[model samples]
Target: AQTVTQSQPEMSVQEAETVTLSCTYDTSENNYYLFWYKQPPSRQMILVIRQEAYKQQNATENRFSVNFQKAAKSFSLKISDSQLGDTAMYFCAFMKHAGNNNDMRFGAGTRLTVKP
Candidate 1:
């Protein structure tokens, strides 16, 4: 079984600043994918970034980047140059890559507020 944990229940950052949301996971499976998703008040789960367990390089999408520490089972998301639109509920998720099982485990979620 795999589980994701987000220690911070809420976070706030000033516009144009940077914030890092922490996430750690416990998993017996080595082959998997980790993701960071953002859901605004609209409730749409948007993919911020994704990282493969086999890839040593971190995944980045625009101002969103991940610090994937495979040994520590840590996958943190760094939102650089935060904007007002970045205010949303962020969720860390994990899914196995081997099987057809599309099941994904998500964290409790961290509400991020980007202040002007």
Candidate 2:
């Protein structure tokens, strides 16, 4: 069974600061995908960023980047220049490479508060 784990249940950051959330996973497949999703108070799930196992370069979007450790099966997200708009519940998810179902499983979620 493939499973993703987010060790931190909550995190807080000041506006313009940076914060990194820790995550680890257990999987036997070598070629899969990882992703981070953000759900705001509006209860809408938004895709933050994604990482392909075959990609050597980390994926980054604006102020969001990922530290993907394929060997260690760890994928962490870093948010820079945090803003009040960044305050939301973050979830880490995993999917197998061309597996049966792409049903994404989300973590319990880590509530991130960006204090201005």
Spell out the clash pairs found in candidate 2: none
Q: Which candidate is the best by TM-score?
A: 1
User: Which tens-of-lDDT digit does each residue in 1-116 have in candidate 2?
Assistant: 88888989999999999999878888888778899999999999999999998998999999999999999988999999999999999999988866576756567789999998
Model 1 residue 10 CA deviation in Å: 0.2
**Total backbone collisions for each predicted model:** 0, 0
Q: Candidate 1: global Cα-lDDT?
A: 0.95
Write down the lDDT of every candidate, Cα atoms only: 0.95, 0.91
RMSD after CA superposition, every candidate: 0.7, 1.1
Off by over 4 Å in 1: none
Best by lDDT: 1
The sequence of per-residue lDDT tens digits that candidate 1 reaches over residues 1-116 is 89999999999999999999999999988889999999999999999899989999999999999999999999999999999999999999999875666779999999999999
Listed in order, each prediction's TM-score against the native is 0.97, 0.95
Residue 48 lDDT, candidate 1, scale 0-100: 88
